[model samples]
Structures are given as C-alpha cells and as structure tokens.
Target: MSTQVKVKNRLSSTVQSLKPSGIRRFFDLAASMEGVISLGVGEPDFVTPWRMREASISSLERGHTAYTSNAGMLPLRVEIQKYLEERFSVSYHPETEILVTVGASEAIDIALRAILDPGDEVLVVEPCYVSYEPVIRLAGGVPVFLKTTMENQFKLTPQELETHITERTKAIIFCYPNNPTGGTMTAEEWKTLLPIIEKHDLMVISDEIYAELTYGRMHDSIAALPGMKDRTILISGFSKAFAMTGWRLGYVCASPDLLAGMLKIHQYTMLCAPTMAQMAALEALRHGRSDMERMIESYRQRRNYVVDGFRHIGLTCHEPDGAFYAFPSVASTGLSSAEFAEKLLMEEKVAVVPGDVFGESGKGHIRCSYATSMEQLKKALERMERLMGRLS
Candidate 1:
C-alpha cells in the first residue's frame, strides 16, 4: 500500500560527474573471473613483517586501544621524524610537524584539503598515481595535468612543468619512484625543478611512498634541498618498504602552519590512525630496517625479471628504476590500451591495467605490477606473449 520514492541522481553532482577509478574497474573484472592472473593491483603482495605485526599485537595486549591525540601518538611521530632524517636527510620537529594518518591515501587527502580553496588549481604530474586528480577535485581544486611521455622516460622536464603553471596554480602534486610507470628523478633533476617551483611560489605535495624502493641510487627528497623544506609536504608510509599495506600507517610532514591546518582537517575526518598501526609503524622505524631492506632486494629482483620478461616477449618496456611495476608498450599489437587489456583478460586470462588509466600519455602501453611471485610473473608473461603472437 505504500508508495516508494525513486531517485535517479541522488549523489553529489561532483561525485556523479567524476569517473570511477580505472584501476578498480579492472580489479572488479578480475575478481569476477575464475582463472585470471592479475597484474592490475598496485599493492605489494608481501605480508607485514613479523616484528611489526608482533609490535601491534603486543600494544593491543597492553591496552593501547584508547585513541591517540588527534595529531597521533608522539612516540610514533618521533620515530617517523628520525626515519625521515636518517633516510632522506630531512628533519622535522615530530611534535608539531608530523601528523600520522590511516594511510598514505589519507595523508594525501588531508594535505590537499588543507591547502586548496574553491576554484584554486593544482598541477598534477602524470603519467602518475591515480589518486591525485580525484583528491584535488574533492578538495575543490582544479587539477591541471602535466603529462609525461615515454620519450622523456616519463620524467617531467623543466620546460614541460613551467608550461602547465598558471597564475591560479597554488600547488603541485609530485610523486616519484612513481606508480604505474616506476619512474624516478635524481638529486640533480630535483635541483633543476627547484627554481621553477620556487619562482612560482608553489606548494609541493611530495608523495614519496616509494622512496626506499629505488634501485642503484640512494633516495633523495625535495624537502632536503636548501630552501625547499618549508614549502614541501612530505608523505610516506611503511606500506611498500616494510610490506605492511594492511597496517595502513602513513604520515605527512610539513611546516607547523601547514601541518596545523592539515591536522585540523584530519582530526575532524580521521581522528587518528589506528593505534595498533601506529605501534607497528613505531616498530618499523626503530628495528625493521633490515626487513625493509630484504623486501626491497626481493622487489628489485622481481623488477629485473619482469622487465626482462616483457622485453623478451617483444614488448617495449621502459626499465623501471624504482617501484614494482613495468610499463610495457602494447602498441605494436595494434590494439588500444583498453582493448589490449580487455582482450588479454578474456582470451588469455591475464589481467593488466590499461596505461591510459594513469593519463592520456599512457594510452599505448599497459601497467603490470611485478609485486607478484616469480612463478606468477613467468606464467603471465608467457600468456601475454601468446596473445601477442596471435595478434600479430
């Protein structure tokens, strides 16, 4: 007897207008299949290290379930401060400069929201991480993409960067040992970028989650450069290096004024990162260095194997100097990135992400995570080769 109300567009206009994550769409497709080999996910396949897990367990036993300060536990922030200084040569006052969050994802969100006002613009470097654009839009900032190409080794050039800046551009989201492409910039490269950033008076949201995973060269931070420290928001976590994705602990470091603004937003939205995760992250900074190194070595080996595998299979892959992904060109197969990926999944049962998911410049390629076991990597490569042979 009751009349039910039907709503066609109940979501916010922005939410409705925004596209669903291309990464998640492929993941959902892979999840529905019975025999798919997924290279679609960006997360590490490694488990949390035993000591960190044990630290969390012990904290739980010690009744650390109570909420930490909105800025997070001082002890954890202290350890984070130590780790950043020791690893990347950047120092911050733990008590005022660091705010722990649920994950690097949350760190990114709060940093954007704290800085952006309505109609402001942020320059997003791409082919890059997937989250930057959406987070900027959600923060009421316009995302002006600065696209990178394979010809440039997927590194943003000084010329390319300046072209994208506008008077309205308030910040730049910079990520490296980049996701999707696995590209990285050296200290010299950072030096060239510094003047442009300084000249424009841009605030940098530097996502260095993949910092510790770099190959050959030691990691460098933009925040470590002469006068860049105060203008940079440094975001990183234990998820990649310590194999603790599920632990979901991350931190953001910035000047006291910027940090205070971010913390206010974080307090209202996240309260604090999980207490157990904080305890585990404290353990990560204190004693998990060796474990982190071991995991990075493993990732390095996997990176070599997968990149070589792609090359052997006749796909042109840019050697990733950092991160656990290989961006291989599928253009020779005469299929669009989406077509190549979709067909590979249905026909060959190997699930890869289309490169364009990262940005328009990524269109002729595909992103394959090498974080999986060597056995799976081998099989996936063989299947891809077969698909290529058939297409040819």
Candidate 2:
C-alpha cells in the first residue's frame, strides 16, 4: 500500500540481495571523519604519470573527443597487445582478441554476463576483490566461494578448487597479486593449476590488474601457460601501475569467439571506452615503464616498513608478495575483525578494512594498505601501537 513498498518491489531481487561493498563503506566513513588515517581503500596514492596525462591533453587539443570503435582505437589495442606479450609472455591478436572497457571492473561485468546462462555456477576464490560474488549473482549465475587460508599464504590451491567444483560449475575468477590480501603465485604454482583447469574444462577469467606491482620478481601471468590462451580471458588496465584510476581505462583479452560475445554486450551497453582514455593508455604503454618502476620501488619500501611495523607491534602479519597491503591478524587483541577495525577507528583514528568483510577466512585479520606516504604509514602504525598497548 505504501510508495516505498512499490519502489522496493520494482527493484531486481539480485540487486536487493547484494550486499554493499564493505571497503567503500569504511573508506567513506574515514572520509567524513577529520584526521582519520585510512589504510582501507585499495588505491594507489600516486598521481597519474605526467606523460599519460599530457598525452590525453594532447588528444583533447587535437579534437579527439569522439567515441572510438566498439573495440577501442586500433593504435591503443596494438600497444596493449605489444605490452602484454612483452611483459607477461602472453600474446593476443590486437584486432580480434582485445576489447577496451571503461575499466577492469566493466570488463569483469561483461565477461561474466556474456558467458553465464541462468543457474550456471562460478567458483570464486575467497578474500577476493569485493565485486566478484555480487557480479556473479547479477549475471544470473550462482557464486560458490572457495576459502583460501592464511596458513597457505592465501594462495588458491588446485586441491581446494577441485573440492568445490560440481556439474554446474562453469568458470573460475582468479586475482593475483590479490586484493585484500597481497598473495601471488609463481609460474611453478600456476603449472599445478593448469591440469585441474584442463580436466574440468573450466573457463578462466584472470584479473591481473596488480601484476605490474609485484616485488622482487616480475608477475607471472597464468595465460602464458601452454594451452591457456584460448580458455583464459585476461582482464587488466592502467589504473594500478600507471596511477590512472580516474581515466577509467581497462581491457579484456580473450579468444575471438569469447571476445565477440563480450563485445556484443559491450557495444550495446558501453559503446566504447572513452576516446581520451584510450589515447592516454596508448601513451602509458609507450612511455610509462620507468614511472611504474619508481612507484614499485616506493611500494616495496613501504611494504617492508608496514610488515615490520605490524610485527613489532606484536600482531601476526603475512608478508605480502605483491600489491600494497599488509593483512595482519588482530586475533591477539581478542577482538573480532569488525570490532578491531571499529575500535581502532574510534580510539586511534586509524582506518583499516575489516578482514571478514573480504570473506569468512579473513576473520582474524585486517587489511592495511601501505599505499600512503611513509610519514603517514608511520603515524598510523604509531597510533595502532598505542591502541595495542592500552588494550594489552
């Protein structure tokens, strides 16, 4: 009888059932509070590399404001092809295999939507990027979470995946140099997964946005494995490495058949990624390697500092292999993940994401991004130490 009831009825059950992003909620709350030091949102604290920004500006000056082709500008796609092949040892034909999307986020949405039919099941690794399960549900697919343990360094095991697979299982979404937890797999680790994937004939949607941000060793893309090129749809973008988050540039590389289906969805829904963003991406590929190196060097330093800081404060932290987060257990404090995060925010004005917000396995931990400056990280850590001392 009420207008609110009518509006609620009109909303899709899928949307209604979906939980809001836990990361965003804390980040927003931190934003509203003065002097809150945030280690919550998984974003690079750096500005977009100047060359990429200048390239976009030059494109605007040249009046390149029109929408690009549905697949994106040829030059940008070519550069992306070259970059991926050279950097990751995975090759995709620029013309047919790549489609630039608004961001990797959009690429993820369309990839799932294009492949999934009603009731198909998708295996999602736990403590993943926040969007995976909700997007699967939105695509009319069932999301089956496979828990990854801290004891195993949060890397998804083929054995764990095998336990979760069933007749309805269609695909698996994997992220490495993962979010929430900065776990990564070596090429040898990927080799073990190859047979399981082939035996099950499962499609792979590999999200490698943080590939370039690894420490010590270069990122190893699973798509580089023999026989994987056709079955894997690789999603990545300039947002992480190039600090071009606001540019909304990303792309997906897949076999032509799969790409065509995703492009069909992309063309009708998004038309094309922004023309200017494509130009910037082109420039980033051409000239941004050094910029990425500098940022990575800074992150490596920060990572070491954050990890040591957590340990010195008497919390158990797994040293992240890549990405800019230190996921430390607050279990010694005798508090739940949410309780620890909330109390830290209230008592110390430091904001870190609650681990369980990522998945059930993340219950005793909190994700603290080291993306901020050394000074800020030091201050946040000091505040955390004070909180721990008082509690102790």
Candidate 3:
C-alpha cells in the first residue's frame, strides 16, 4: 500500500479553492527583478517616525516586554478612543467597545467570524481591498460583490446598495478612502446610504485604515452617523499614516456585545498586539501628528504628479480624493489590464497592480501607488510614457 499522506484532499475545500493574491503576485515578480520601479504594493515607502521608534525602544529599555491583556493595553486603548473621538467624532469606550488586534486584517477576520453564521451574506463593495471576500468566505459567509463604477466616483449609493440586498444579507463591509481606487464617500453620500443600512438592519464592518491619508478633505467615520454606532465595527490602524506597516497593530471599535464577541476570538487567536508596537502607537497618538501631516503633504504632492503623468501619457485617470493610489484606465491601450501591466513591467521595468484582481468592475484599470519618492515616481512616469508611446 502507498504510504504517502493524502494531504491534498484534507485541505479545507474553501481555502483550497481560493485564488492567490493578485497584488502580491506582482510584488513578488518585481522583487525578483533588478531596477524595477514599483508602484504595486500599497505600503508606504516611509519609515516609522523617529519619535515613535524612540518610544518603542524606551519601552524595551525599561524592561516593558510582557503580555498585555487579551484586549490589549488599557493605556493604548484609551488613547485610541480619544484619538477617534477627536479625529472622527466617534466615541468608543476603551473598556467595552475596543479590541486591539494583530492588524486591520485580523480585526476584519474576527469581526466577520463574530457575526457570520454559515451562509449569511456579506455585501462587499468592489473594487475594494482584496481581502474582504476571502475573509468573508473563511468565516462561513457568502460574499455578495456589489460593483461600483468610475462614473460614480466609486461611491456605493443607497440605490446601488439596495439592489444588491437579500434576506440572507447580514452585513456590509465598507472601505472608504478605498484601496486600489482611492475613492471616498462624502457626508452627504453617507447620509443617503444611512436609510438603506437602517432599512436592512445590516451590521457594518468599516475599514478606515486609510482614513487619515485623505488628500483634500477630512475623513468622516460612518460610525459617527446617528444610530450607526452600535452596528458598526470600525477598523483603523497606524500602518498607513504612521508608516508602521511592520508593527502589525490595529484596533476595532464596536458595541459592547459585538466587541466582547470579537475579543473572545482575539484572545484565542492572538493574545495581544505586540507590546512594543503598542507603546510605539501610543507615542504616535500622543506626538506623531506633525510627522503624519508631513507624510500626508508628500503623498498629496505625489498624487497630483502621478495623476498628471497618467494623463500626459494619454491614459484617462480619475483624481483620487484620498489614499495613495491613482487608478487609471488602460482601456485606451486596447489591452487587458493584465496584458498592460505585464507588458509595461517587461518593457519599462515599471510595476503596477492590475485592477481586475480587485473585482470585475476594476478591469481595464491599473492601480499605481504614489507612496514612493518623487525621484522614483518621475522615473516610473518616464518609463510608462515610453511604453504608451510604443503602444499608441
């Protein structure tokens, strides 16, 4: 008899069927090449602010390494609560409404796990952050993709949202100041969608990870809306604004019952966020505002430059109101998004993520992140221009 382990069939059919990340595929490909200019990864090119690092180092120097409570350090939670109240006008009690997780990724997973029973439907607005559908499925929920268009500025209106709802719909995941598209929703738009959310009685997992990176306007948290607080699971983290991607810390704010349930999952899955990273994040909230603003300004400059560059290259590009990406249509080139990206990568040594991976609605577009330096942006623009010239 063959003694080989039958590991193939033992894998969860759901996980086994899941597709690999399209973004990471390009990132890995670029990493393998020499002198490839990457606008592929969503991570900030900046390092963590010096003061934040100093704070973490101080904690380590003072022998502060220890496991925090399963819910996370009370001090950090308090600061997060205060930060949210001041920044977004959302109030979450540190003791009862907050759960600090490994990162926004984990917060999302736990939020879905806490609420979703088998076959419950989650309304995921697309071209969103890529993780939403996979995470939903992992939690035994069905992901119902609702496509948003460039003509709509990628906003999910009450009308569009209502059309996608069904009796099985239990929650909606919103990621404004969105990834891939850099789209944002205005207060008036949220006001319009409020009734639909209230009508359906859906729980909301609001990923505001890129909240502070808005280009011209302040970010509004949906949790601040009247009667929306209790049903909203608000997730935000320091990775984007503070350039602390390596820290792996993020927090979720929800009502007591929801938070308590998530905490139970968090305690068993991840005991606490890294103690050192928590201390660093506390310092960031306390004193890193100026550094964050400086980074935002740099990103704003880059956004303008990249947008103009795409237009100059004869691509129709929408102005992203927030986040670091510029989503430009490659349809004019008469090539698929994957074709455009691969050809550009090979010809010009420039890397960008194909938009289709975000969702079907994202096809014929490419996401180019402006989180890199001006010099690199200029080089990438020149290379892209050359490629466009050849294609045209």
Candidate 4:
C-alpha cells in the first residue's frame, strides 16, 4: 500500500483571508432557532410579478433553454437600452456597450477585474454592502474604505472623498439609494463631487441596485451627467424592484472599450446569463413598471413605520429615504452591535444584522429590514423594545 503524503495547503491567499458574510451568519442562526423573527437579509419579500414570471415560464415552455450571446439576448439588450434612456437619461449602444451578467454581483466583479491591476487602489465608501471590499481584494485591487457618518445622514462629503484619493487610486464605487443606510444623493450632490472626480481622473462604478425604490425624489445617475457617460460603469438589475432575486439577472453599461474588456473576462467565466431570465427581464422592462411602483409605495410606507418604531424604542434612527432598511444606533443599550444582535436572537428570538459588519463606522448600530410584512415589522420592533427594556 502506498502511503499518501500530506500536502501543504494551497488556497488563494486572498480568498482564504476573506471573512464570511456577517449578514448570512446571523440569518443562519435565526434559521436554526424556532420562532425567530429575522430582519437580516436585504432581499425583498414579494414574489416576482406574475407577468414576468409568466414570460419566463412561457420561454421555458417553448424550450428556450439554450445559451444566449455572451452579451445576452439582443432583444433584452435593446430593451435595456430603451429603459436606460427613458429613465436615467443614459444612452449606450445595446450591441457594443451592454453586457448582461448573472447578477449585479457578477457585474461588479467583472467590472472591477477588467479595470484593476495589482496594487491599484479603489476608494470604497462605507458602511456599504458587505461584498465590495472583498471583491476588490479578489480582483487584485486595494480597497480604501471612506467611512461615512450618521450625522451627515451617511452621505459622502466632497472633502472626505478628496482626502481619500491618491496617485494609486484608480476608481471609486458609489452606491445610492444606498444599502444599509438607505441614503440617496441629489443631482446637485453628484455635481459637487464631479469636479474632484475630473481632477483625479477617477472612474465611477455606480451601483444603482435600489434606484427605483427611493422616496421623495427621483434617482440621479452620475453617468447621466455631461461628459461622464464614458467614465461611469452603471450597474443595476431586476432583483430588488421587480422582486426577482432568484432570477439572477443584471447588466453593465459602459463605454464600448471598457465594456469590451469586461466582455472578454465574462466570455471565459460566465459566458451568458439565463435565457429565461433575459426573457423575464424583457417583460419586466416592458410591462412591470406598475407592479414595481406598487411595491415601491409599500416599501415607502414600511420605511416610515420602521424608522418611527426604532425611535420610539429609544434608538436614534435617521430617516431612510431609499432602500428598505432602518439603521438604528443601539449605543444607549450599552452593548456592542454584535453583542446586541446575538443576544437579541438568543433571548428575544429576533435576528438583525449588526452594523459593524458593514464597516467600522457602522459600529454601535444595527440594521433592520423593513422589507418584511407590516405585522412582522411590528412584532420585531416590540421584541426589540423588550430587549432594550431588559438591557436597561
């Protein structure tokens, strides 16, 4: 019998060093416990609209299981082009500038990988969606996190943005109708930051995943601004607004050259997004606006209730103008964010994402999703108030 020799571990250093997603950890804990009310995930609670679902089903029924062009189905791309022009005032040649991706997640990965070289720096504003920093590291780029504060409603100031740029800085990822904080920026705010971007010659990776869900104002895409179309990589998907998370369909729009580079990487890796999903997304663009608007209005009402509930429970919460989360400071409870989250799950059967997982700036706060039903949000708030009472 030959003896097998023990080999040295050979996982990639970057992948090995990445931490597990904190949002998923708490969510799994809640899943294991009986009767726990979970507010950990950022996903919408609604099902994909019937028209979109029927479109996907009809495509599947017609045996449309074959792969599309790596850039995705041409019809879907064309519809995307029309949607972008009509809604965001950004125009791109559907044939050359749009690369349909598996999800906005894949769009972010391929966009960064296409542009970043080893040791290149990407300024990442935080507290952000948990994936940005890790994705940057995986793409051989350094992530420089610019932490935003609650006092400023978590919007990144021009001075703070300028202070973080250096010669090595190549791009900046900005998300609005932002994750975790639900912050939205006006066109004027975008204008305030554009001069610095032009001076630095930095590429903007704008993640507008929650664009349609904003309250009190329309979303402003930096790509829509004069002279920015060539430098901005605009990313969005049908997941949030159309309630199609499991559909996993998204697209990236950029100048032809930049998109071509990303397409080369995507060709070898993803090849193409799902044909059924593309069909569904096409239907979403054409006829799903009314459904999306209804969901947005529901989210707006829930957002108000959740923020008020948090404040009533003695936690300081800023009004979230976009997205479906309420970020509330738990500093008065005298417990660290993680401690509060763990204890709340164990003792009160309520699960929330600890804010610190987003970034250091998010410490002393917790993120509660208002995406669930109103009854559940009320129940979660009552449980949180009970937990606060115990802590006191």
Residue by residue across 331-355, what tens digits does model 3's lDDT show? 9999999999999998899999999
Q: Which 10-residue span in candidate 3 carries the lowest summed lDDT? A: 2-11
Q: How far does residue 55 in candidate 4 sit from its true spot (Å)? A: 0.6
Candidate 4 has which clashing residue pairs, if any? none
Candidate 3, residue 129: CA error in Å?
A: 0.9
Q: Where does candidate 2 stray beyond 4 Å?
A: 1-8
The C-alpha lDDT values of all candidates are 0.90, 0.92, 0.93, 0.93
lDDT of predicted model 3: 0.93
* Residue-pair clash count for candidate 3: 0
Indicate the TM-score of model 1: 0.97
Candidate 2 local lDDT, 1-392, one digit each (tens): 65644343778888889998888777887888999998886789999988988999999999999988999999989999999999999999999999999999999999999999999999988888889988999999998988887789999888998999999999999799888899999999989888989999999999999999999999999899999889999999989998988989899999999999999999899999999999989988998899999999999999999999999999999899998889999999999999999999988999999998887878899999999999999999999999999989
> What's the distance in Å from true for residue 344, model 3?
0.4
Predicted candidate 1 versus true structure: per-residue lDDT over 103-143, tens digit per residue = 89999999999999999999988887888888888889999
Poorest lDDT segment (10 consecutive residues) of candidate 2: 1-10
Residues 217-328 of candidate 4: C-alpha lDDT, one tens digit per residue: 8888889999899999999999999999999999999999999999999999999999999999999999999999999999999988988888888999999889888889
TM-score of each: 0.97, 0.97, 0.98, 0.98
